[model samples]
Target: MKIVVVSDTHIPKRAQRLPSRLLHELRSADQIIHAGDWQSLEVYEQLKQYAPVNGVFGNTDNEDIIRVFPDKKIVNVNGFKIGIIHGHGKKMTTVKRAFTAFNQPIDCIVFGHSHIPYLKYKNKTLMFNPGSATDKRKAPFYSFGILTMSDELHAQHIFFKSK
Candidate 1:
């Protein structure tokens, strides 16, 4: 299975449209996971047009988004348990959510909201954050991520230079 992950796309505020490069990956990906702060329903619709999308609502997201998404979601993709959450509150809060909300055996945790991409593993848990797609700070970069599963899982962070 192949999945594209992105977050913090504060559309219309940060960027008018997604990078053309990202759109190409979206078309090729089997699934897309959006971590949050989407800022517009159109963003979601555009993503869905490319592939199936799994998303979580961020703190900045509206009530309609909240109602549609749980604070945490567990998805099984080709036997890999992937946990999705828009990390809110504090650092500890998100850590706690990972332990309590995701009780099942998980292969990875995908989260957003610091607007900084991170990939780390402690013990066996893989934690990933794709950063802000419409980054207002730090080199004006937009990014997303990709996870590929075959014999094992492979992940990469993709950064795009905004012109």
Candidate 2:
């Protein structure tokens, strides 16, 4: 499976549209997973054009988005369980918060907020933050994530200087 992961696309608040690089990657996606902070449902609609879309709602999302998604969720793709969350909280690091969001076993965790691309293993679970496709913040470039699965699940970040 080819999973295109993205988050913190603050939409018109950040970039006027999804980055071309991200859209390009989406073309080959078997599925798309969005972590959160999507400012508009139009973004969701656009993504669905490429593949099946699944996501968790973020702190910045309004009721409209929240109504369509959950604050946190777990999805099973190709027999691997993946936890999804938008890492925004009053205390603790975003990574720590995401790690604790799920009580059951999962193969990976996908989160956004703080807009920093990260790919690391926590015990057996791979934690991934695709960063901000639209808002890179202090980061050098805009970024997103891709996960490919066959015998095992592998994840990596796709970074670009322009969004």
| Candidate No. with top TM-score | 2
| TM, every model | 0.90, 0.98
lDDT (10s digit) by residue, model 2, range 27-145: 99999999999988888999999999999889888888998999999999889999999989978999999998899998999999879999999988899999988898899999999
Query: What is the Cα-based lDDT of residue 155 in candidate 2?
Result: 96
Looking at model 1, which ten-residue stretch has the lowest summed lDDT? 93-102
Let me know the TM-score candidate 1 reaches against the reference structure: 0.90
The per-model lDDT (C-alpha) reads: 0.81, 0.93
- Name the lDDT of candidate 2: 0.93
Query: What total of clashing residue pairs does each candidate reach?
Result: 0, 0
lDDT of 1 by residue, 15-57 (tens): 8988887888888899999988887888898999988999988
* Model 1 lDDT, residue 39, Cα: 77
